[model samples]
Target: MLRYIAFTVFLLVTGAAGADRLETSAGSVAVTQVVGGLDTPWAIGLLPGGAFLVSERDGNLLYVADGTVNRVKGAPKVSAAGQGGLLDVTVARDFTRSREIFLTFSKKQKGGAGTAVAVVRLSENGKRLTNLRVIFEVTPGGSGGRHFGSRVVEALDGTLFVTIGDRGDRPAAQDLQNHMGTVIRINRDGTIPGDNPFVRDQAARPEIWSYGHRNPQGAGLDSQGRLWVSEHGARGGDEVNLVHAGANYGWPVISYGTHYSGQKIGEGTSKPGMEQPEHYWDPSIAPSGLLVYSGKLWPQWKGDLFVGSLKFNYIARLAGTPLREVEQIKGPETERVRDIVEAADGSIWFISVGQGAVYRMTPDT
Candidate 1:
């Protein structure tokens, strides 16, 4: 059994299962395995009663508590193929009383598939969900299974924001008529937010908050409640952008990276109307999860941004207005870090896809 040391001191113990003790500029850090035997867990939501809700890519929502993983029933049927399947899960702030959970998944449509969102009520015992319903779904589902930019975040005012990819159709990102390659906003019941960017634009999807995003997977609200996202670019040019309503992020039009065929993208990374990324990675770490650290155990890390590196296998520590990678935390437990979350207690939790386990990071003692 792994022992829990007091948080006030610094001590490193090794040889524990799923625990990797490392030293960093902040101080000693320890990552311990909380639960394992998951099948490609994509995202996690913190539950009120000390349990975690984890979504697996194979179309299963798992309830993990007391070191045991239980499969949650009543999730929407998903198209679990090629970067699709069950994705992000977010719990409502008043979860204890509301029992409402939001989910984003790759839903199969008539001839193709698209990213879809659903709202469901988790049972009191945490066994299943009832009253399942789709709150939002991307329009004009297209063929192929790539680039489902599915991530869900609840804004401070309880509005919902979801990301949808271009579905391998690069040019579609620039089109506002369909839901592809856009960030959309809606009410809790899936109604279009009146303040959404394109709500008045009859030619555009009214739910679109912003457009021209490529395969965005990581999204989170900062300490100030500002929404930010990390998206993947071709060959290179991964980006982190501060999302704004009515904004147009240059995707295919102005990219720092070349196409997979080594062709130049757009008119070269600069245009009058397109918004620039807050930070970008040239070689592409393939960012997946994002969290703005509200540090509790490590007070020094508060306000810093924590991002997962899927390609390089590490957690990136970014700082500054135009974010820059200051540190990369990687060790035995660092594996295809897929999703990241900061618990109410301020402990850091992440889904390590490489290890098929959910790992927790805390101050060493």
Candidate 2:
């Protein structure tokens, strides 16, 4: 019994249960597709009550509980064109007591759409949201579908973290005065945090946390209170970066990848001032949502990072210090994964971008 127990412990430590995984260099088996009958699902906010709140790109918020999905009405009218639609949804940490929720989207505006992030108080039974207000908005307005600069996360200290896309205007990423291409730190109510790095830049927006990024679709905190961001590159060089406060991540410049027509992006890789990625993809996986595992369903997958690949149609189970890829949950061309959330019950929740379905990948056991 002692020998058997020792071997089990070893397996868990090495993360080698080898259950089923996306068919990649380190993984095997295809991801089982769950229910597939919704719109373009964007994000998943797992609630404290074990249910989930899902958002679609068409401005619809749905409540999913006990395996039933109910379309939530009264969502704000969003710009339903191109990349302008409802995006991420997240319930407040004290949602049970406060009944507040947070959302990020592309708000329709003159000429183009302005990126907006808001936190509102939800109804008692989660039917509708009241007191809706925009807490963050990208100024000078963006028109194209290039970048909305999204991803909202609240640290344990109650401060909120938000990412802004470069809005297809590369040079704006270097300008801390603009919200585009920045990670902003704000209070839970959409006010600026006093300790923010750019709070004193005088010329810079006070919300700026880090600047110079393309589109950081995925941003989350690790166990040690560090921030992890996954962003799409121009041609190659999709990157997973460790974000630091008030730092600069060179965008359109110093990228490992060049332009679509083989033009050099910037001053080439490795500049003096720009931060580098912990890991990057050469072919561009079009990475979107991200999550750090704190689950037990796949006992071996604890303490790792999982990202949903939109272009690759796979879920990358990355490992290592900053997480290199050890496995992938490719669905065999079944779905475009937008977000991956490890549920409170240890199940994997995959949100499909095109299919608009909420799939829960559970252990076959």
Candidate 3:
């Protein structure tokens, strides 16, 4: 049976609660609210000089600083329909010097059929995207508007890790050659990484890094240099994965969730060669954006993994252990969380996917 999720209203209306100690297998500490009241904010990017950039799914880019916000100019026009819009925005790794930004979005294509992923550079002056480009794109064959799983991350090696959705095609998830249902790795200049798994394969897109994902909306790097991804399963199998080169995640083939009619998904939960998730949620937390926090403000949370939820509307603090829940934080907008990032001052910032709100969580002053 299909489940229904309710969205919380604008986040600015909420008040901060006193800090409380957290308990986790990895470790935990106090959590305090810093600021709130954002409008369907979808993603956050921390600038070098203690400034912040926030994206609203409805196509507005916001600049938040000191205790206020200002709208940026020239946001790309987007579809903003069912699960589509000005999606993700991120600061370039060299932002301290270059003052450039990169992001992904689902914009309307020529036909009413598909959506394309655009990666544009945000000017430092917050005026317009100077060097706009569609670095990599997916097949725009949307049937009923679901699953673009588009999240962008700059790898330590200067490669871009991009997550693509299964495009509402179940069986295609197992197809080795398609761009859908795969994590793609590309150079910052939009070229396929030479060392990618499919780079030399004539049958596969050279950019394909890993395969068999439903919609991995969240990705981040931990202290150990491991790349972690959070994804939504068919109905119940929300997963957290440690990404490995050339691994297949086994989406439609095996899942913690059953079919719409309560039938089996595929062969089974475990199969040969397919890499299983490091952790998964059976009841479906609808995990969205992910961040491995390293800020000093929350020294207790330094090196811990923080994930946002769409259905649960909480920022879940998970233990580094294989598969177990550690802490669930419900203070943000209580809406579908779209992205989370560490601020310049070591604070944690996040955005709401529907209400277009941005929030900050910091240690007790």
Give the alpha-carbon lDDT of every model.
Answer: 0.87, 0.77, 0.72
Clashing pairs in 2: 22-328, 22-329, 22-330, 149-164, 149-165
* TM-score (C-alpha) between model 1 and the true structure: 0.94
Give all TM-scores, in the order shown: 0.94, 0.88, 0.86
For model 3, how does the per-residue alpha-carbon lDDT over 1-365 read when each residue is reduced to its tens digit? 01001112212234335454544333443544333555466778787766677776677777655544556776667777777666777788887676667777776665532334455555655546655677767653555467778788888887888888887888877887677788888888788777888778898778888989998989998877778899998667889988999999999888878776778888889899888888888778888899998847756667777888888887888765565567877643546777888776776777766545565655443
lDDT of 1 by residue, 1-365 (tens): 12112210111222134457978778888888777666788999998768889898978887866545557889999998889999999998878888999999999998789999999999877889999989889889978989998889999999998989899998899999999889999999999878787888889999999999988999999988899999999989999999999899988899989998998998898899999999999999999999999978788888888899899999999997667999998886778999999998898999899987788888888
As a whole number from 0 to 100, the lDDT of residue 306 in candidate 2 is 88
Q: Which candidate number maximizes TM-score?
A: 1
Q: Candidate 3: where is the Cα deviation over 4 Å?
A: 1-38, 66-68, 110-119, 332-335, 353-356
Query: What is the TM-score (0 to 1) of candidate 2?
Result: 0.88
For residue 149, give model 2's deviation from the true position in Å: 2.8
Name the lDDT of candidate 2.
0.77
Model 3 residue 211 CA deviation (Å) reads: 0.8
